[model samples]
Target: MILMSPAEPGRKFIDSPAMTQGHGTVSLKSRNRNSRQLLSSSEDEQYQKERVVSPEIMCSLKSRIANKQNVANVTRNQLSTSHILDASANMTISKEKEERIRRQKEKQEEFRKHLIAKQQNNVSVDNTKNYCDDTALLTRRDLTNTDENSLLTEDSDLLLNTTKPSNNKSVIIVDSREINGAQDIVSTLRFNHDINVVAAQLDSCDYVVSVRMGVDRKQWSEFSNGTNRAKMTERLLEMCDFYERPCLIIEKDKCKPEEKGRILHWTKYVDKTLVHLIQSKMTLFFTENQLETASIVADLCQLENRKNCAISCPINLNTDQQNRVKFYRSIPHLSYVHCLFLCNNYKTVASFLCSDVKTIMTNGKMTEERASNVYNYIRRTFDTQMLPSNYG
Candidate 1:
């Protein structure tokens, strides 16, 4: 309030005012800059957190997508495998169907052939009846009416007594397959004729007639009577026992003329398999199919004066003939064909037997003694033109 040096005091007060105003303005500016820096830093931190969360979400999505893709690939693979399996199964089914169709076709063909045969036979019978009827129409009634029954009876008696076998002379027809009941075929003739049937192991009959089908090119049986193999293979035991004679051996097969060795046939095409059984040792009436050599042997057997003759082909004797030959047939567990291969050789007859002996002995569990006995006996019979003495 004192007016002492007014200019100096006024100047100092004015300078203080100016300095305070400037400081206040500077402080407000500094505070504004600090607030802006804090806000910018907070925005940068939020941006960083957003970047981290975005990457995490993206990675999780990518991983899930990859898993889905892998699952799709696995499903495709499984589908492919299933397709392959189904295709293979279809192929197997197709093959079975083809086989069945083939069999059915064959059966139909056979049935057709049988029908044709029957038709032809019926036509032949009708023609025969027509001819007989024509003959009756041409004949006079008085001639036909007189003593018809008596004349028929007389002719039948004459026919029955006329077809007698040769006296003590035996004719045998050696064949492959055993005929069924040969005795039945000729027994009526024997009963009406003056013939005696011997009960011995080896009996002789007159004029034996034989027939066979599908005989092998070079095979013969070495079995004797009363043996197990012989019993099984000999389907026509009545013929062998009572026929007591050689019969004609008529074989059925379309064998080539140039082919060598004897023909073979077996009974029981699917089962039992009785095969290559020799019916007799007398004569062989070969089909036009056998070779010259076989035909020659058949001729030798057919000679009227001949007593006993071996088959055209060499025979095997060491092994049980029935066992070895029959085994290859339809018989179960009896066929050693898998073990021992086929033998069509026709050497001294023993070659077939000797070569197959080892297998036979092993299969039959036969002793050397038993085998030797068989061998010696078979050799003797083959060499001596006699039935095996062993046949009781």
Candidate 2:
């Protein structure tokens, strides 16, 4: 039997004689080792030629890369500088705008001051004439009634007695500071409205109509002034602390005779202040003139008087009694009047604690509900679980 073997890889097939059963066969053949080495050496030489780079070409490639890098760096620097220049330009423009606005405000304020000064100057002459006329009437009335000795005695009385006689009329306490600005209103209240207008140094408000009512009067110009805005807010808030029914009265602005300018529209600041006052639940009233404002004040005084809320001057209290009043005032929902009543009736916190709810109502003149709340606050047993978790 004749058998043939498979040819090996990377070798040429050649006819060869084999001593296997005296048969001829085809087998793989390989080249001589020296010839293979020569061929490999020649191929390496050609590869080296292809892979190797010339110095000139190398320098050229490096120069091209360097040029690209320089261009990129120049572009980045230009972009950064442009951004910086734009930022500086914007800053300068904003500064210019702010300066222009500040200058405009300054000019407006100066003009307003000048106008106010002019109006005051004009009004001064008229006020002087009116004062002289009032003095003349007073002299005529005083001269007819007494001798020099009696007149001398009554002069001191006249100077001391500035308040008008009430004659069963409602009384209104006017702040001394308001005398200069609201002389016309005061005169109107005294003579026309027949209100007992008493001028006193009131710290909390310009006018007090009742035990729980206060009024702060402001002219349009004063209310709208930027400088007085904070002062007005502070005054109103302080009034709120003192009175249950605090009111703000805005009177019309008085101008010079020839001045034709008027506030046709409110400013944004004015609108914002109005919104804030509304949110605070402040009572606001507007009047066209001094007479109208006086009428409004008179109406408030009469209304409160009808309601039996007439202002009661605080009675003198010793330090102990005063402390008692303070303690009573700390009770929830109790008014100053109710606190005074409690202080006067109970005389001590221990006594107040021992009283029943009905006794509290009788002594403090409080409603049943209010008396019950006080009784519960004083006598209720405290429980550990009833306390807030954060207390622990």
Candidate 3:
């Protein structure tokens, strides 16, 4: 009967055991809450200690935290974008600069090609470079009858000691119709003075010969027409560049009936335009003088036969030229800088100084020490204290 007894479904069973299990769970929860409270108090104490630190130290710590946040933000978002944007800006500027340089180089190259084409056209070329203080005329040169090679000679360096002859230099020449006895004129120009002839080999000399095209009264007049002959003058100057050089036309037969008249008209037209274009371009000489005219002028300025002279600053000078030479001689000489300018408007003084200047250029570039010696000799020879202000 005791074994058969079963517990009812709703009956309270093991009351002590239930209490023990519930008590264990409640104790665990209380222990967790106490641990949380301890952690919160520890955090508060650390915050108070930080507040007691100096402003400098607190600011530094805040900055460090902010910097760390910034780093995180940058790493998470725009790191690649900022790098790409900076690179793009630098590349854009570099591209713009490259484009500008390319355009300038293109223009220079194109101009050079144009000049080379003219040279190939059998035109006599002459490159005249003037260096001096006339600042105005220093860039211009009027060719007369003289051998350019002779002027370039060391002992015959009559005009300049620093002559920078460019391989791509330009030349100027005349184109005149054949006149009576044109062969004689050509021979005179060629033999008497060293004028370039296109028929001559390019390897032998640097020049392009431009043969006179035509001589007709009406055409010459047409070219020479307009106010102050402005239009005609421009055309004539341009005609020089056609062949881009000038040479005498040696005709075996007599000139055409209208040739002389046309030639005469052309000469007058050019004479009218001479003063205007002289600064930028164009050199003029009488048509009758022939092509040798330019060479002759070159020779006169060059000290071909003059002996080299030595000059020095003397304690006592007997001549006025001595003083002028000493003044210019006192200055130091630069290696690349040459072409002397003795500027004075007075005629007599200019003439005397010019003679001395000629002597100085007779020798090539010399050391600064030699200038004094050369100037002294010039002073002794010319006896003037001033130099010429005007020379073509």
Residue-level lDDT tens digits of model 3 in 1-392: 32323655333342458877887899999999998999898889889877788989889999999999999988867977888887998899899999989998999999999989988653333222223422222233224313423323333213331222233221112223322323444455445554432221111111222111111112233434555465444444433432222222211223576665543434654564445545533443333333444344333222221221111111122356345534543443311111112211212334434443333332323332444545665556553557676766
Report lDDT (CA) for all predictions.
0.41, 0.71, 0.40
Clashing pairs in 2: none
How much is the lDDT of residue 135 in candidate 1? 43
What's the true lDDT of residue 334 in model 2? 65
* Alpha carbon lDDT at 141, candidate 2: 39
* Candidate 3: residue 322 Cα off by (Å): 54
Query: What is the Cα-based lDDT of residue 43 in candidate 3?
Result: 89
Candidate 3 stretches greater than 4 Å from native? 1-185, 194-196, 200-275, 278-281, 287-392
Rank all candidate structures by their lDDT, best first, as comma-separated numbers: 2, 1, 3
> What are the RMSD figures for all models against the true structure?
23.0, 24.2, 24.1
Please provide, for model 1 over 31-148, each residue's C-alpha lDDT reduced to its tens digit, 9 standing for 90 to 100: 9999999899889998887767677789999999999999999999999999999999999999999999999999999999999999999868755654464345324322655443
**Steric clashes per prediction:** 21, 0, 28
Which of the two, 1 or 2, has more TM-score?
A: 2
Off by over 4 Å in 2: 1-167, 312-392
Quick one: best lDDT, which candidate? 2
What lDDT score is found at residue 105 in candidate 1? Answer: 97
